[model samples]
Target chain A: MKATVHVTLKPGVLDPQGQTIQRASEAIGFARIADVRQGKFFEVELSDDGDLEAARAELERFARDVLANPVIEDYRVEFLSDLPAASEQE
Target chain B: MKATVHVTLKPGVLDPQGQTIQRASEAIGFARIADVRQGKFFEVELSDDGDLEAARAELERFARDVLANPVIEDYRVEFLSDLPAASEQE
Candidate 1:
C-alpha cells in the first residue's frame, strides 16, 4: 500500500522560500498571484499485510513524528487509494 | 482562490533526502516501510476575479516554469477548492 504525507507551514509562519517563489512569479508576469506557501510531500510504499487499520495508524505516526516539524508546520496523511476526488478536499 | 502544486522527483532520480528519511523511519521502528520518496508542495493564493479557467492555466504555467525543476522533477497543479476527496486520486 502507499501513503502520502503533506507537510505545510503553519498559517502566519514566515516562509522565505515561498516569498522567493512569489516574487519570481511576479517577475515572470503572473501579477495576479498574491502569496505562496511552500511545504513538503512524502510518498511511502509499505508492505501491506492486509492490516489497513494498523497501517494507517503507523503512517499517521510517521507523518507526525518524522515528516513534520511541529514548531512551524502542520501535516496530513492520506492513503493513496483512499484519496478523494480532486474537487472535494484540499 | 488557492492552488497547490506538488513537485516530485522523477522515477529513478537519486534522492538522498528520501534515503535519509527511510533510514530514520527504520530507526524509529517502522520496519514495514519499504521506501520513501520526498517532494515539494506549494500553496498559492491568487486574486480571483471569477475566471477559473484562465487561472488554472496560468497556475499550471507557473508550476511548470517557476515552481518545478523540469529536468529532474514532475509537478501537478490542483486548485484547493477543486481538489478531489482523499480516496479518489493521488
Candidate 2:
C-alpha cells in the first residue's frame, strides 16, 4: 500500500521559500499570482498485509511524529489511490 | 482563488533526501515502511476575477515554467477547493 503526507506551514507562519517562488513567478511574467505557500510532500510505500486500518493508524503516527513539526506545521495523510490524477482537471 | 502545485522527482532520479527520511523512519521504529519519496508542495493564491479557466491555464504555465524542473521532476496543479480535506480518509 502507498500513502502520501502533506506538511504545510501554519497559516500565520512565514514562508521564505514560498516568497522566493512568488518572486520568481512574477519575474517570469506571471503577474497575476498574488501569493505562494510552500510545503513538503512524502510518499510512502508500505508492506501491505490487507490491514488498512492498521496501516492508516501507523501512517498517522508517522506523519504526526516524524514528518511534521506540530508547532509550526499542519499535516494530513491519505492513501495515494484516493487522490485523483493530475490530468483530471476541473 | 487558490491552487496547489505538487512537485515530485521522476521515478529514476536519485533521491538522497528520501533515503535520509527512510533511514530516519527506520531509526524511529517504523519497521513496516518499505520506501519513502519526498517532494515539494506549493499553495498559490490568485486574485479572483471570476475566470476559472483562465486561472487554470495560468497556473499550468506557472507550474511548468517556474515551480518545477521538468527534466528531473514532475508536477501537478489543482484547485485547492477540489481537494478533499485530509480528514476524509478511507
Candidate 3:
C-alpha cells in the first residue's frame, strides 16, 4: 500500500514561496489567480503488511512525527492500494 | 474555481530529500517503507471566469510553463470547482 501525505501550511501562516509564485504567475501574464499556496507532497511506498487499520495508524503517527511540523503545518494521509486511486477519505 | 498542481520529479531523477526522509524513518524505528518520493503541491485559487474548458487549458499551459521543470519534472493540474471536490477527471 502507498500512503500519500500532503503537508500544507495552515491558513494565516505566511508562505513566502506561495507569494513568490503568485507574483510570478501575474508577471507571466496569467490572470484570475487570487491566491496560491505551496506545500509538500510525499508518496510513501510500503510493503503490504495486511492490517490496513494498524498501518493507517502507524502512517498517521509517522506523518505527524516525521513528515509534518504540527505547529505551523497540517498534513493529511490518503491510502492508495496497489497504485490505483488512493480513495481519499475525509 | 481552484486548480491544484502537483509537480513531481520524473522517475530516475534523484531525490535526496526523500532519501533523507527514508533513512530517518528507518532510524526512528518506522518499518515497511520500501520507497519514498517527494514532490511539490500547489493550490492555485482562481476567481470564476465561467469557461471551465478554457480555464483548464490555460491552467495546463501555466503548469507546464511555470510550475514544472519539463527537463526533469512532471505536473498534473486538478480543478477543484468552488473549493469542494475539483471534479478531477482524468
Candidate 4:
C-alpha cells in the first residue's frame, strides 16, 4: 500500500511563507490570489497487508508524532493505488 | 469552499529535500523509513458556486502551469468544506 501525507497550517494561524507567496502572486499580476499557505507532502509505501484505513491511521500518527507540530498544523491523508511499475518489482 | 493542492516528485525522480528528511528521520531513530519524497501543499479558498470537479481541474491547471514542473512532478487535489467560522462571515 502507498499513501501521501499533506501538512499545512490551521486556519486563523499566521503563515509568513503564505504571505510571501501572496505578495509574489500579486507581483506577478495574479491579483485573484486571495490566500496561500505552504506545507509539506510525503509519499509512503507500506506493507501490502495494510488497508487504506490502517495506512491512514499510521500516517496520521506519523504526522502528529514527527512530521508536524499538531498545535499549529493540520494534515490530510491519501491512499494511492500502487502503479503497475511499482508493483512489478515486488 | 476550500481546496488543497499537493505537488510531489514522480517516482524515480530525484528529491534532495526528501533525502534530507530521510537522513533526519534516521538520525532521530526511524530505521523503518524506506523512501521519502518532499512536495508542497497549498490551501485555497474558492467561490461556493464551484464544484469539486471544477475546483480540481482548476487546481490541476495551476499546478501544471505554475505550482509544479509537470516534467518530473505530479499533483493531487483535495476539496475541503469551508469552516463554520469562515462561512459565518458571509
TM-score (all chains, Cα) for each model: 0.85, 0.84, 0.86, 0.65
- Residue B45, candidate 1: Cα error in Å is 0.7
Docking quality of model 4: it rates as: acceptable
Backbone collisions counted per model? 19, 0, 2, 0
**For model 1 chain B, where is the 10-residue window of minimal lDDT?**
B81-90
Error of 1 at A62 (Å): 0.9
* Interface DockQ of each model: 0.71, 0.65, 0.74, 0.32
lDDT of 3 by residue, A56-85 (tens): 777888889999999999999988764222
- The DockQ-based CAPRI class assigned to model 3 is medium
Writing each residue's lDDT as its tens digit, candidate 1 over B1-90 gives: 888899999999999999999998899899777789999999999887766666777888888888889999999988778633422433
lDDT of 1 at B8: 100
Compute the DockQ of candidate 1: 0.71
Over 4 Å off, model 1:
A82-90, B82-90
Chain B TM-score for all candidates, comma-separated = 0.82, 0.82, 0.82, 0.69
Interface RMSD, candidate 2? Answer: 0.9
* TM-score for candidate 2: 0.84
The TM-score obtained by model 4 is 0.65
Measured over the true interface residues after superposition, the C-alpha RMSD of each candidate is 0.9, 0.9, 1.1, 3.1
Cα lDDT, model 1, residue B11:
94
Please, what are the lDDT tens digits per residue for candidate 2 over residues B4-83? 89999999998998889888888989877779999999999997766666677788999988889999999998886753
Top-TM-score structure, candidate number: 3
Candidate 4 docking DockQ: 0.32
